[model samples]
Target: MRVTPQPVRRQVEERLREAIITSRFMPGEHLSDRMLGDVFGVSRGVIREAVRLLEAEGLIKVVPNRGPFVAFLSAAEATQVYEVRAVLEALAGQGFAERASTEEIAELREVFEELAATRPGTDRMVLLNLKRRFYGVMLRGCRNAYVARMLDQLLNRNSQLRATTLSDPKRLPQTIAEIRRIVEAIERRDPGAAWAACREHVHQAAQVALRILNQQARDEAAQGLEVALD
Candidate 1:
């Protein structure tokens, strides 16, 4: 477990953010202040302050009459995220190819191998952690602080919405192939190829994810129409 350093409130805030991202708290789930206070061993005031921080981050939704609930995005909102991510990650990939040292390139290759070895039935959290590690290497090796900062914001929200896409067994092989192209490009220090590969990877993931979200929306609409006819 990673220990968060801070005043009580920041620690609690990170705790809540991780929970929300991991689906431990879950989308649209009511967050009871009392329950959080008991669980975190903090006072209600501390919970409120922490929740307020996440509300500003767009992970928590606070309504006029209702208390805080985990925020769930519409498909349109998710589309914007993926579009932004493609450009940001592409830049990071190009930068890493141009600037990363030999060791950094090798480290990325090793991480890619681990990811490729993962079977379809592998644990969800494990895959997420590995993917995070892979991106961490790319960001630091890229040595661009500005791009890293922008990607961090999108990644926080994107992870929550990517659960369905990442878990699709049908996409696993394609994902590995896409990421392998990125690793190979970076290893060869081909900046343009790395950029294109990264952009294409995000494009493919967006397609799979958006398709699922749209289908779910259609299913819900059809269900509501049935109730109306009743």
Candidate 2:
């Protein structure tokens, strides 16, 4: 059997998507096709194709004359994303609790333990990777193909918003505790409790993210007011 090579366009698109998701290319920052082509060692056409893919993923926006820029999420959009995520995640948790085998639960537990062992001052990237792995296990064990697919599409924006939420020094412990609660419910095979735990975790995280966004908006408004008065 011949092995199929991954498409160059898809490879470029994944790199660009990861860059945007990791905040390497910050939201609203312009992406130059020539510069990106140089950096990726690809042609302008390839870069453009990759960028259009990212645009479809909602990680980039193309302006007619201005080219493509990283997508920015407003507080309202973030709230809506998290609200939908809460429902989907709760469903996943419930499904996992109801269906996951003993071996699968053990695998998820191991991931959770690794996550819990992460120190407060550990690198954010490390924590993010562990969190991703934990959720990967959950998605696999949950046995809901449609829910997995839907959540996969939202993962990039979810990563962007999570960076903001997890940046708060006070939130790390709370996040750990929330995950612990969910895991405990799953371990007990309590679908209702697991669903509630998952929803509550997302709800609390949304509140933190919304608070930060509101504060930033207020600061921007005050600055504009000062400029007007002057």
Candidate 3:
């Protein structure tokens, strides 16, 4: 039996999980216990516990006799997840618009202001964190626990797909603008406008992901043909 601190294991696991979701660790990349332990300065047992947590979250896979690898979503699965997320977030946006107070709306607006003012040189992790906070504020306006939980799960999954889309220069400005529109609608207490903005935003993101997937498939096919010719 390997001895390790539970807190260290939990922290390392959470950080690694975020890295995987952000594509810092690409899909199908092997996660070696020793390597991760060294990187995190933790015991192998701690790494194991952390890996187990990520596996439970469905963000990583631990195969029997094989190894742990970053999880990948199939094309169909990706589409399904995004579709469900669109509906869930739209509902949450509507609920937030309906229930948010003036102070709450002001707080969200402040967050948007900060997001907008941030420099372009900001890192992906920082941008991702800001995005999470922005949605978190909106979700808090939704008073229902069940809806909040479901929305959180959907968005958590979305962070994985979001990394690829972030590679596009056009997506950043477009996303910021779309989020600004949602914030504006929420501030106005217009549930219809807020819902519309949220749905349209998510649909646009899904379109971006589909485009990336198509490009990836094309690249793979080209590589395969080149290998066959050689």
Candidate 4:
């Protein structure tokens, strides 16, 4: 049987969504409908439909008169996202440790090994993809549909924030150590330890991300004040 082709609008949406998540489309950058239509070789209507889909996913925003722009995560939004992610990841870790088969655990370990082997100065995208693969194994082995679904919903936004958090050279070694702890706990089939390790990793990442977001907000505020004084 022949497979059905995906709709043009959906294809465009996925391409744009990946671009946004990978930071090829920076937050707050304007997205021109005509330009996108030309780039994607699609009609303006198709571009509009793709933009609407991304907007619903919180990856794009359409202003009344200014057209569409990539969505930016405010500090408050980032904090809430991380808070939810921490709890969900802990649940996933617990489920994976308690229920995953020996083969599944081995699979997760294999992915973790790849992630650990990534050099400290590896390309950001390469590291991010490895991390995604590691998490994919855990999510699949967790055997909780809701946990997987919730995490999936947060992934794009997580990538958006991660561009900042993962840029700090110091965070690479710390992140690897944290992930190693989680993998070690899972290897022992210790659900409680796995849950704790996963939660702690998210917590530390949230702290670093929040610090950068807060500083950026302060700098923007200062710039606005200077403009007002002028």
lDDT of 2 by residue, 1-230 (tens): 99998898888888888888787898889999888998788999999999988788778889999999998878898888888999999999999999999999999999989978876777777777787888899999999999887776776676866866665568888998999999999999999999999999999999998888888889989999999999
Q: What TM-score quantifies how close candidate 3 is to the native fold? A: 0.86
lDDT of candidate 4 over 4-78, digit per residue (tens)? 999988899889988998888899999999889888899999999999988988899899999999998999999
Cα-lDDT of candidate 1:
0.88
- Give the clash count for each candidate: 0, 0, 0, 0
Model 2 CA deviation exceeding 4 Å by range: 1-3, 227-230
Off by over 4 Å in 3: 1-6, 118-122
How much is 4 displaced in model 1, in angstroms? 10
lDDT per residue, candidate 3, 68-187, as tens digits? Answer: 998776667779888998888899889999998788888888888877876555676667777788878888886767778887876766676675565456787888899999998988
Count of clashing pairs, candidate 3: 0
Q: Model 1: per-residue lDDT, tens digit, 106-128?
A: 99999999999998877778778
lDDT of 2: 0.87
Whole-model Cα lDDT per candidate? 0.88, 0.87, 0.82, 0.88
Clashing pairs in 1: none
